[model samples]
Target chain A: MLITNEVPDGAGHEDPGHPERPDRLIAVREGLEDLALGDELVTVGLRSATRLELLRVHQGAYLDELGAFCYEGGGDIDEDTYATYDSWPLAQLAAGAGLAVVDELARRGDGVGFVAVRPPGHHALPDRAMGFCLLNNVAVTAAALRSAGERVLVLDWDVHHGNGTQSIFWNDPDVLYVSCHQWPLFPGSGVPSEIGGLAALDRIVNLPLPAGATGDVVARAFEEVAGPVIDEFAPTWVLVSAGFDGHRDDPMADFALSSGDFAHLATWAAGLAPAPGRLAVFLEGGYDLAALRHSVRATLSAVLGDPSANEAPTNGGPGSDQIGRTLRERASTLTLVTAQRDAEEAS
Target chain B: MSIYPRTIAVGFDGSPDAVSACAWAMATGRRLEAHLVLVHARGLLDRFDRRDPRALFGDVVSELATRHAFNEARLSWHVADGDACSVLLRCAEAPVFADLVVVGSRGRDEHAGMLIGSTSLQLAERSAIPVVIVPSTTSEYHEP
Candidate 1:
């Protein structure tokens, strides 16, 4: 059972030339269309993210400012991020999509919850909007889960780091943030050195891969690095920041993953959940239309136990050396971090 | 005894407004003998010239450098892949920790009539340190 909310990918939140456009949503729908799930896919109308839910990961003032900005006929939030009059409402729906899916998944108790919402939220901060994100949707959901006493594990596989997610969950001991992203890319925060906040040491796992890394390298990073971290963390719920831009054809960042690779990732993520219905996936990045469709198709199908062989899994790529180096250096990094924390506390 | 603003960050986008901003920041840097960190946000989708922004700006930035002659060591360039506001804020906080941040009132994107660019305004509101927005009408600023 694949559970998700059906929200209109509104035109109210769009910039003409920006890659994070309305058509990206259409591409996702087309991907699902290709799947032909036929009654296996359950779609529900999205409820607007309540202020209480949003306040979990975002500040009250920033939300008010964003709402006011949208009401005033929003323009460019930054060079790459933009908002129009309908953006605030649409963003609310997007943020709410995850919460709705989580609840539906809980009630049904048997399906993977995948949300393909607009203005992807992993890049959004507590009080600031960055990287075309209006609100931290995944963070919001994680915080709610943590509040309900469930240990949450956020797996960010976007081509770019989910800097905002890391920052928000940095201090929480119950929530672990793991990211595998292309290094030297936008927002620039997913280095191994950024282990986690003092309280949550070793909780943040940063797998900064090279540009053309294949699924093989990523799998090793997971099996060797993230696997141990996830095992020790033993999270009750798993959330994925599922950005498909690592696809070879995506123009944004360079990663050689194909649709088949997405199938591998989704299958791996499903295994991380405590149970069958405990995993949820949210859209983060992926600009190329064709690539987005194929990747999404493969990911959802694989998660639903029907693997899409439309694209073949790739191997013999780069970044294996980097993973070995990370494994070697992790101990020293933790020792140094612990010493710094001690010195600060002693002072 | 604050002695604040010992370092300043300036946003550069190779636009005319950015040129004016550079001129103003350089002038202020001269008065205070402060470090000038020129920041350019290379968006992920940005295929904008990867070469030094100064190289892209050509004679205009060259002219600004010649006019506001300061120690070469005092000026550093940072081309980061991020949002303009986020990158500038990061420069002011860690690694750079600039005491002040400055940018043009508008960049290439803004409509000509707007009072201030969105990036400038957002930075001003969020930055812990002071921020300066150089107007397009600004000519080269000089201090006695």
Candidate 2:
């Protein structure tokens, strides 16, 4: 089910000056409406995430404090992040939407489910919320799947690194985490050398590009680095940390990706899943309203297998070639891991 | 006020023939003032599994539901993960759904004079309730 927090009360969690406002969801809903996709999209209502679900990815004390802060009329967790009286409920709704998508996909097996939620989650650490993120929505959902004994693959295509998601799964070998983001960006954590720790060396793959990187660089990184590793991992479920801030028009980032590039990346990533594999996309950080809407439509088109709906290819911005070459040259880790897995199985 | 307690489940795949079957179901649902549940089985394909059909056909379903909205009947949709026949069979027997199931006589490319398609045949044999196989010609009998 396509999920969104469409309730009128959702507006109470508002900060007019903040980029993450109620208008983001409005644009998403209107933009989807403009597409006029008949009988092809169904949206489910949002429910609040239970306290137990929040504990999956956040510290108990931090959760308690955050709830108390919100209930006490709310204030800033830090300079960039703020919470209102309704912020706690809205955040629970965001996290719950992700969990609901996981539940639907697990039961139905085949379907495209995306959550166009707010208060982006990739930057939120497990211990506390940051980067305008109140909770790690995708991390909580992934942790739930892990507890169910399902191997999961988290493909984060957001502009900034998915530091929180990576940190949550840093030690676990069952969840393969991959991210393609702009280097020298906020939170500054997605370095290639910072792959998984001692136990899960090759499980984490980071393809950090320069400011002017293009869609071609992202496509190549997926093909060269992510695809091979996913083929080796054979995860039972695939969850996407979809962030549209990488779009050329987005105000938040420096990446030069066009709207079509987002679709191209999603199409390739969707292929890594097994036949009829469940792909649940969690909305992260796309600040530009128009670009976000267009990118979401294009991504849906590609996922639904309509090539004609995708826009014509555009230039892969400046420095795209250098980034592609560098990733290809250093992408031996996935190959090495695949070969080892094959040998181990044969033995 | 919807007088009918039974909910009608129609097997739809966005095919022309399926559209005709939906029209028939809609007319019947209007007459009975029963809720309509459109079921599309987006089963597995060889290379990739079928994505949610609603992402592609939601407007069409909404339009159909609107046409019968005057009957005061609620319209809902389910895109299950299995093949059409089995999904329809399951829907027919489920407690939430009605015993009556509706389907197209034949899919897009089936013979014009054929009585039923493979899906319809399988559903007819396995369905616990009555199965209505509307032919492509039924489109003309209903109001647009």
Provide the overall lDDT of each model, using Cα atoms, as 2-decimal numbers.
0.85, 0.73
Which residue segments of model 2 deviate by more than 4 Å?
A1-9, A307-311, A319-347, B1-144
- For model 1, residues A216-258, the per-residue Cα lDDT tens digits are 8987887798899899999999999999999999988889999
- What TM-score number comes out for model 1? 0.87
Query: Which DockQ-derived CAPRI band holds candidate 1?
Result: acceptable
* Segments in model 1 whose C-alpha atoms lie over 4 Å from true places: A342-347, B1-9, B15-17, B28-37, B48-56, B66-76, B85-144
Per-residue lDDT tens digits for candidate 1, residues B20-77, read 8888888878778899888888875564223456577646666787788865578888
lDDT of 2 by residue, A217-315 (tens): 777777776677788999987888989888888877778887788778778867776756377777888888888888877776666666322455456
Give the candidate number with the greatest lDDT. 1
